[model samples]
Target: MEVFEKINYLISEKNLSKKEFADKFLSLNPRLRTTGEAPSYSSIYGYLSGRREIKIELIPYIAEALNVKEQELFNFDLEYSTEFNIRYSKDAREIIELLQYAPKNMIEHIKATLQKFKKSYEDGVKEPTSS
Candidate 1:
């Protein structure tokens, strides 16, 4: 798949609209645009429509905003990609460890945190201050 199609698929998988994705992208990389100004919605639209290309420099930022690794936005066969295994191995191990030793209360806390953050994210509210 082309980069544009991959990006669209990832965005859809995350259930984020173009505007929401762009907003998150800008939030994660404030320097994507001028200071105190959000990125133009039209730019995002253009990329999604394949009228414009996403800058290569922004790929990492976009991937991070979408909660994925940078390579996931490209067309690569995972089964043959050693880099994919190397990149995700640590994260997969950490997730396994978390599942093994995480107490029920701690699991609940993590779930609640994710739920609260998802709600706040959708509502455009500031993330609640973490203690």
Candidate 2:
């Protein structure tokens, strides 16, 4: 996906309006907040509206502000076409990588555990309060 498209996706996923996203992005980043080149009101509008190119250097700041990886803004496909996209958090990505090397039996065990967790959450099973 294009940079703007990814930005839009994040904006929607995080339940933030365009202006709010821009405000938060500007406020959270100290370096960019002070610099004139920061993604200010006008610049953010330009980026989202496809009137300006979001500079490559700004990708990291954008990702950090949104709590995502910088690669998500780029159009590169990490794996082949048949694979699921790696759009997960850093911890999830690490788990995915670790699972790739896990034994088949261990993978099955993990899957079963995950399924149980999913079912539990889906069924509204709350955790016990800690003593």
Candidate 3:
């Protein structure tokens, strides 16, 4: 999906209306217009509708409005996500490379071990308590 589509999906996922999204975006004061003011509500609607391109400068404000990281807007596909992780995370890259050479049985055993680790970590997590 395109960036606008991703934004729309995130808005719906967050249970926000277009108006609410526009309100939040405006409240962030993106200030991308030539006049150094936040874009008008109709302009925000245009961005949502793909009638206008989302300015690069507004990405942070848009992300803040949506309560998401800026990369979340662009990371629409698994290929991009995997490439990003592999580029930035040595451990992730090594794990993927190692998995490629692992036998099926070994992979299954690894999965089980990872699942146990995850469960143990989750079990150890304590919920925050009110003072």
Question: Number of the top candidate by lDDT?
Answer: 3
TM-score of each: 0.51, 0.55, 0.60
The C-alpha RMSD of each candidate to the native structure, in angstroms, is: 14.9, 9.1, 12.3
Tens-place lDDT digits, model 1, residues 1-131: 57887777678766898889888887875345434454467877887889987766678878987888787777445422554443554455467557878889988888888788778767987555553
Q: What is the C-alpha lDDT of each candidate?
A: 0.71, 0.69, 0.78
Q: Write the per-residue lDDT of candidate 2 for residues 51-129, one digit (tens) a residue.
A: 8987766677778777777766663344212343345433454697688789999999888887776677678865422
Native-structure RMSD, model 2: 9.1
lDDT per residue (tens digit) for residues 49-69 in model 3: 999998889999999999878
Poorest stretch of ten by lDDT in candidate 1: 78-87
Clash pairs of candidate 3? none
Flag the better candidate by TM-score, 1 or 2: 2
Model 1 residue 54 distance off true place after TM-score fit, in angstroms: 1.2
Q: How many Å off is the CA of 63 in candidate 2?
A: 0.4
Candidate order by decreasing lDDT: 3, 1, 2
Over the full model, what C-alpha lDDT does candidate 1 score relative to the true structure? Answer: 0.71
